[model samples]
Target: MPIRLASRSLPLLLGLLLALPTSLHAQQPTAVIAAEASLESWYDPLEALGTLRADESVTLSATVTDTIAELNFHDGESVEAGQLLVRLSDNEAQADLRAAQALRDERRNTVNRLAQLQSRNLAPRGDLEDAQAQLRQAEAEIQALEARLSDYRIHAPFAGQVGFRDVSVGALVSPGTELVTLDKLDVMKLDFTLPELALGQLEPGLPLTATSAAYPDTRFEGEIDSIGTRVDPVTRSVTVRALLDNTEDRLRPGMLISVVVNRAPRQTLVIPEAALIPEGHRQFVLTLDPADEHRVTRREIRIGARREGEVEVLDGLNEGQLVVAHGTERVRDGQPTRLLGILDETTSVPELLRRGRDEAEASG
Candidate 1:
């Protein structure tokens, strides 16, 4: 009888031990970082990979085949519009131009003499008319020669930086031979592609931000300059072009960039992402009871767009309500809690705990 009684009491003892921990845990307040759900502007982001390009870019080449006579620009030199960059051998063209000028002068003298003689009835009207025609032809010939001479020279079409010079003085070059590259760098054009599904939201003037691996810490800001006229049938995407100010000249052509386009802003309840508790497909958070600040209630919530360290709470939460941002694993529904410092984007769980310990010692 004594052995049987001991066995029954052993089970009771185990049960009591388990019950004691629950009672103690319920009374002991758990310390956790808390945050308030507040109303803030929220944006939906569309992301894509982009390629950077100069606002204006072109490859300079010779218009006619000739030998390079003069190189006025060095590699990577900045030049202004209409500035002479190269002068090919134009000796033959110059000679022709001089001859045309002399012929024009002679024709002009002949026309004047004939006009004077015709006015006094000493020359025929046909002779004066013929001289006038010859003078006009000579002038036209001079214009044609000047135009041909222009083909032997190269000028900067716009103000920009020039790339490497491909030829040197006395080097033979032909038509379509690349002389250099010119790019306007004061503004940058970012071209990216987005899916056709995003076409409705895409338009000119939409704000965006971009980042490059080369400059990881820098964020480039710009606005949409235009949208593509047609969607690409193969990719089911449309091209987007944005203009970013490059006054500092930090951006370059062909740099790979990651882009984020922000949609219209709307007011929504936002909370630190640390406060969320994920269970399968649903989400939950521990909220402090209004009547009992120490007590917590596990509430289910729906979430929307998330960015950085914060998340948008779509349902089951109200603005200005307090939720446990940290130590959710240590607390249970209806369990008592001790408030620590509120968690923010810049604050960490360990930092908040350190502050709590300091405050407790001060108060004691």
Candidate 2:
């Protein structure tokens, strides 16, 4: 009986030992992460989705009705201005030109003969005038035929890269038929739309920056070339165009890109997103006192636009003030916090907040 009683007590003792540590740990305070503030320039960039397009684009088409005799340019070939791209059946044009020349030659011979006769007083004045008129008419006909012959050969209108050829050799095409597409891509155009509120800030020649998903690390700079005079009633946005040098031709048309337009520069404060704590509809953060390294105070911040893991604090924060970065949720107002190593604390809050607010207001 004594052995059985001891076994039952042993099981109960083990259970109590397991539960005690959990309860004790639950009651203990958790370590909170903290950050120190420093003054540095911060940018609250306005971001928008855009597409890359060629500065000059056109579709090549035939100017006259004819059957294609030869296709000079291959698909996706770079061509120069005035380069021959297509050849049409010129046999008929050549024959017509020859006929016109023959008629002109006969008329010229008659005019010469009549002029000599009139000089000798052997021909009537009316006859000489008729011969001269006939010569002039023949010359005009020849010039017209020559112009028609020139149309049989199609030339490039501008220096650009050619797209796929639409017509093949021996294909019959008319004036309106598409032959190929030509695009000048040495310079590219980036087009994006901005909110109507930004219309006041937007102007031609404003500096802008852009990035593409294909080359995210690389940044391209440009300036606003034009702004839409009228805003779209449905979207309430205005179109903006920026011209960028794409000499390398790395950027292609229709590629999606992100645009950032800098309107003006001002000073503001900025912070990281991890430092913010949201309670209900309001936002707050844990701020540390410079005098006391451990004492933290809950600061209610008027937040603005957020991007790239960072947040802009419009109010309730100041430059050079330490703010808790990590472990914000565990921190309470006036709680003592352990200062971990400051991670990227070198940023101004005021300038960041102002820029963020401007962008948000523009978007709204």
Candidate 3:
């Protein structure tokens, strides 16, 4: 009978030992990194590739064929509008101007003398009229010569920087020969294209940002100033133009850049992306009990758009509630938890873990 009692007691004692560990595990709180849901401005981003261009660009060239007489600018020199850049050979033209001026003076004297003589009846009316016509013709000739003289010179059309000089002094050049290039670099224009579906979200004065591989650490801010009226039928896309301030002259034409257009922006509740526990098609999060910080309850949440390190919580989560951001793998619904630290979009996970370890060592 004593032997029979010992066998029954052995099974009961084994059962108790197994139950003890299970109860202890349930009672012990799990350590986890948590993050608070908060409201922040969120933007839907539209990305595209863009090309940079100067606000105003032109290739300077001479309109008339002639030998270069003088060069007043160097390569990459800034000039003002109407500044004389090059003077072609005008020696022959100057001689003609002087002779025309002499003839004009002679005709004016004849006209004046004829008027006086006609008033005294010493000269016939026809003679006075003939001298007047001759005087007018001489003046017209001088004006025509002056206009032609302007063609032999080159002047800057606007205030900008000039490119390299392709020809030297005394080098004969013909019409359409490129002399230099001028560009107004105080402002830059960025052109990019987006699909036709994005047209409804684009308009003038919309703000944008751009980045370039040349300046890896820099970001350029601009706003939409123009939108194409027609969409490409083949590509189903529309062109957009933005204006960026280039006061530093860092941007240049034909540079490939990345563009981001901030479309719809609004304030929405957000949490660190790591806090979401995705199960198949649905999403869930572990939230701490307000009254009992060590107790956590698994919650099903609806989410919207996601940015960088955070996600927009559309439903099932309220602002200011804490959710598990780290160590979600070892946690379960209605599990007791110990708060390690609060995590945010800007927080580093490894750093947070180190801090938690240090705190644990201090407490022990």
Candidate 4:
């Protein structure tokens, strides 16, 4: 009888446990999740690498062979147009010019005397003509000598900053020898290469932006100046050039730069990056259905470009749908979910703190 009573009591206790109120059970609040639907108006950009170079660069050279007598300009000096840069030894040239002038004067006198004789019939016609020819030849010779004397001096062809001088004062320089380099850096060029697939997208005057590691925070703006006519066979890429304003002179030639090509504006569906779930070769997200009492459902979506903290959804999603941004792994498809609060309407803790500080200052 005692054993039967114990068995009955055990069955009764188990029944009581099963019949207990749900409130009496160990109950915890369901996990709260956040979500946002994909929306349009996401900006996608193409990035490339490039180098900055001076827009105009040239090597200054001697046009005539001569001894450098005086170097009027120093290395790395800013010179104005037509400024005298160097002077060669001009003693021999000056003497030659003087001799030519004297011969020209002598010929002039002979020609005048012959003309007088011809008028009086005291000289032959051929003699008078010969004197006239000699005067003409002498005049031509003087002009040629004067031109040669002008080559003894060198002047700046354009207004620009000069580079290091290769020849010094009293240094003999031959024709075509490099003296210095000149460059105009007020505006610069950014040269970069793009893949062959991007060739169709390139066009003149397209807006471009670039930044250098030296100045990471500052962005330089420019536009496509030109595109190469042929693609490089080895790299299968085409060269592109952009013109950037360097009025501040902060950017220098040969500086490595990162380029961003601003393609056509596009409107694409975008969602918070946190909502995406990657699994092998597929990506998915959890969405809430309001009509079905906020039931969570999993959805596969095609992702496009990502910028900032948002990602563009190319397909498999639409606007006005709620996606799970947090606590996604805990939920299942078609499962009933009780929203603790509207996740999309919530702001970050840092943002809230900043706003509170701003409000306090305003009130004070």
Best by TM-score: 3
Ranking by TM-score: 3, 1, 4, 2
- Predicted model with the maximum lDDT: 1
lDDT by residue (1-364, candidate 4, tens digit) is 4545576699888888887865566443234455556456544477999988888887877777778898877777878878888888889889988998999999999999989989999999999899899899999998998888778877777877788877877788888988778777889999999999987777898888899999989999999999999899999999999999988878888999999987765677777788889999789998888788678878899997888778888888887778877667777888866554434446753454466557558977
Predictions in order: lDDT: 0.91, 0.81, 0.90, 0.80
List clashing residue pairs in candidate 1.
none
**Which TM-score value belongs to model 2?**
0.64
Q: After superposition, how far is residue 22 of candidate 2 from its true place, in Å?
A: 39
The predicted structure with the larger TM-score, 1 or 3, is 3
TM-score of 3: 0.84
* Each candidate: RMSD: 5.1, 12.0, 3.7, 7.1
| Candidate 3: clashing pairs of residues | none
Using lDDT as the measure, name the better of candidate 1 and candidate 3.
1
Which residue segments of model 4 deviate by more than 4 Å? 1-44, 115-125, 265-304, 310-349, 353-364
User: Deviation in angstroms for 17 in model 1?
Assistant: 18
The TM-scores, one per candidate, come to 0.81, 0.64, 0.84, 0.66
Worst 10 residues of 3 by lDDT: 1-10
Write down the RMSD of candidate 2 (Cα, Å).
Answer: 12.0
